[model samples]
Target: MLGATLVSAFSLAGCGEEKAGAQLQGPPPAPVRAAVLERKDVPLRYEYVGQTEGSRSVEVRARVQGLLLKRTYREGAFVREGDVLFLIDPEKYRASSAQTGGELAALRAKLEQTRLEHNRISDLFAKGVVSAKERDDAFAAYDSAKANVAAAEAKMQSEQLDLGYTQVRAPISGITSQEVRSEGSLITTDSAGSLLTTITQLDPLYVNFAIPGTESMQVRRQAQEGKVVVPAEGYSVRLKLADGSVFEQAGRLTFEDRYVDPSTGSIRARAEISNVKAQVLPGEFVRVLLDGALMKDAIVIPERAVLFSQNGPMVYVIGEGDVAELRPVTLGQGVTGGLVVESGLEAGQRIVVDGIMKVRPGGAVSVIPEPEAGGEGKPVAAGKEQSAGNGGVN
Candidate 1:
């Protein structure tokens, strides 16, 4: 009898311990945040590598041939229109202009004397005191003197123009480049030696990029099929710097090549942006973002909710009974905050957005709807009492 009582007491203690353990492990369900899918129009954006250039690049050249006396503007400095850039020796041009002016004055004095002679001859002829031949000769001399004065006047004007060209001035307002020919160099008016420097306008910068021909054709097909809607006004451009910072100013499309490059298989495109502060430099590389295309009636989800497997991308769909079901999804281009769902998902379905790691197919999950900004947080539905299974997407 003592042995029986001792065995019974030990069995009761074991049962009580088992019951306690079961109680401690109450109905465990994976806690996760989910969002109801909705179909809405979302904007599409395309990204590509690009490079910047000046809106206007001009070569500063010398118009007259002479020795470069000195450079007036500093190299790599911002210069205004009509600002003096260099000085050429003007002594020869000045002397020629003075000599032409003296010749013009002498011819004008001769014209006056000839006119007086012609007038005196006309009066004598009217009084029959001189021959008609003499009067005709006087008139011819007066006309010849006047022609000489006119020719000398034109020569003087030409010399003056050459004198003015000695002082080289900027043709446009822009940032200047380094001097190609320094001071004391013999400058020439020919094409080979005329280039003095370069000037680039920086207020409105051009960003050049290329789009693959295949991608462009695909977009056109999609547009015709009613899957994509392009903006009528055209795309708005934004830039991302190498440091991953967005540019402050926005831009618009300026040019698009009609034909694809045979070598690169891409069509060149360009955009113009206002860079009043001169923040963007020419020849700098950047990332181009083309905005203004709309995806029609598309389903989107958070990037964190996406899971990858050997098959493709998958997502956890909260089905009936608040059970997490793994569904394979086809993804399209990414939108502002999430990715567009191409297929295998629909509107009015809930998917796991947060705590995806703890979810398993056919396992109960406590569904917490993502809280709106500045709103109270609460669980959308309490999961059924079930064990948290260990199975997950591979």
Candidate 2:
């Protein structure tokens, strides 16, 4: 009986020591909140710096050379098409026109006299009353007289046109700039001297920008692979002014260059926006936001789950047996909810969002599923708190 009691005591002591040793050997699995990823089509947007310009920028110039007699329109004011902007000295042109008119009248009278003589001579030649040479001379004189009359008529028309050009008119309805030549200044019909003012139409403004070639290629490749869906109607554009306020009017992409610009290595593009109010001025810099692009079947995760290390951006994924596995992911654009996973993730995988610091590769974890709504999705034993708004570089 004594021997049996001693053996029993030793066995109990060994069992107790074994239990205590097991308790102190390692810690329990880390409690982390994880979420299962799902694939869905998500909208995408891109932004670029653009410049505002008038749809039509016209340099008003004088067509006729003369002294600038007067400027009819106010400087820096809106003017309508065909409105008289300037008056050049019309005295010389008027005198030239009058001279041409008088010469035309004399030529017409001479042509009539030659015609009557030619008819009488033709009748005489047919009746054998005149020689063939005489008849030919009469016909030649009549032809010469007609030619003179036509030449005089042409000169008269040109003179009248010059007289009309004395009054410089606005070619388009737009805002006009200051006069290049003041009244009494000589305005010549030459490249350097003809400029009277500049007119810029601001009703429909143009916004110009460029797209990088690399990004353009990537988008095309993704679209061909069924990874992206570009809208059929083209991208919808919005402008953000320099003051950080979004323009009330929206625009559309109107033009894109066929070839990439060699200097910039980007494709030139343009957008048209309604600027009836003239709120946006020309030559101003603005931010252009392009929308209506979609990412097809994309996997997104909360940005807080992403951890940056020397190796790159990585996340803690729950593997088989609820073990944490470190996964490297390629990031794309940021969306409203989180960052898009370009690669290195799949649907149905659980990623640790909250208590991310507590997760270790190859370590066991107790996954508490993230809630659908409300709460921080914190585990009972929280590690370090992380906000879901943290973003990775796109």
Candidate 3:
């Protein structure tokens, strides 16, 4: 009897322990981070690797043959239009000009003397004081003097032009590269070489990038349909630098190529941006952010909230009472901040952003206080129960 009572008591204790375990609540809810959706204008942007180019570039070369005497401007300096960049040996040109002027003056004196003699001879011939041959000789002498004077004047003008060419000036206002040919370097007009320096305009810079041919057509169609919203002629564009910082100034789409490249099957597009401060430079790689097309009531979520599954891309949504529901979302193109969801999600929905691994479907949860809209801190949700409910949990 004693053995039977002990066995019964032990069995009852085991049952009680099992019942207590079943009634006990699960561990405290696992904390999770979440984000609330708000309806606003979300910009549709396509990013491509692009390079900055100067809108205008000019090569400063010597036009006349001479030895480079001095570099007036320092290399890698900003220059204005008509700024003297280099000084060729102007001594030779000056001498040539002076010689031409002297010759012209001498010819003028000769012409004046010959004209006086011709007048005298013509009067004498008219009065029968001298023969016609003398008058004809005087006329020929005057004409020859006049021709010599004209030739001397032409030579003088040529020399003056050559003297002007001795001073190499910047054709456009821009920043110049280092001198290619230093002082004392002999240069010629037909040397088949580049100039002393290169100047590039940086105030309004150009960005050149190539887009797939298919995308180019789509952009054009959208623009024609009035679906893509663009600014006025001087609208602003944003640029992403190589270091991932947003450029201060905005740019505008300047031009697009009409024909696609047969080899690459891409069309080139250019955007112009104001670099008044000279912050942006040529040949630097940048990412362009165009903010023309606005999607009305588009669904967006933090990129980290999205998860890839065998079924498709999905996100954990926090429904009423902070219950996390795994939702399959159709994704569109990705933008700067997040991915665009085409379907299966709506605006004003809350989605899990952090601590996503600790929750199951229909699990009781607690939502912690979050920062205000567009603020820093993210909203966090904590699950209260571990029980896997009726809904499938994957």
What TM-score would each prediction reach against the true structure? 0.85, 0.74, 0.75
Local accuracy of candidate 3 as per-residue lDDT tens digits, 1-394: 9999999999999999998997786655556765666555567777777899999998787889889998988777899999998888999999989988988999999999999999999989999999878888999999999999999988999999999999988999999998888889898886564378899999899999888998768766766776555445533468899889999988788887889999999988899999988898999999887676665555667677788889998888878866778899998777656887778877667777666677676665555655546754443333211222232223
* Candidate 2: segments with Cα more than 4 A from true spot: 1-36, 258-263, 302-328, 349-394
| Candidate 2: Cα lDDT at 37 | 79
**After superposition, candidate 1 runs with Cα above 4 Å error:** 2-27, 113-143, 370-394
State the C-alpha lDDT per candidate.
0.87, 0.88, 0.79
Best by TM-score: 1
Task: Give every collision pair in model 1.
Answer: none
Each candidate: how many clashes?
0, 0, 3
RMSD of 1: 5.1
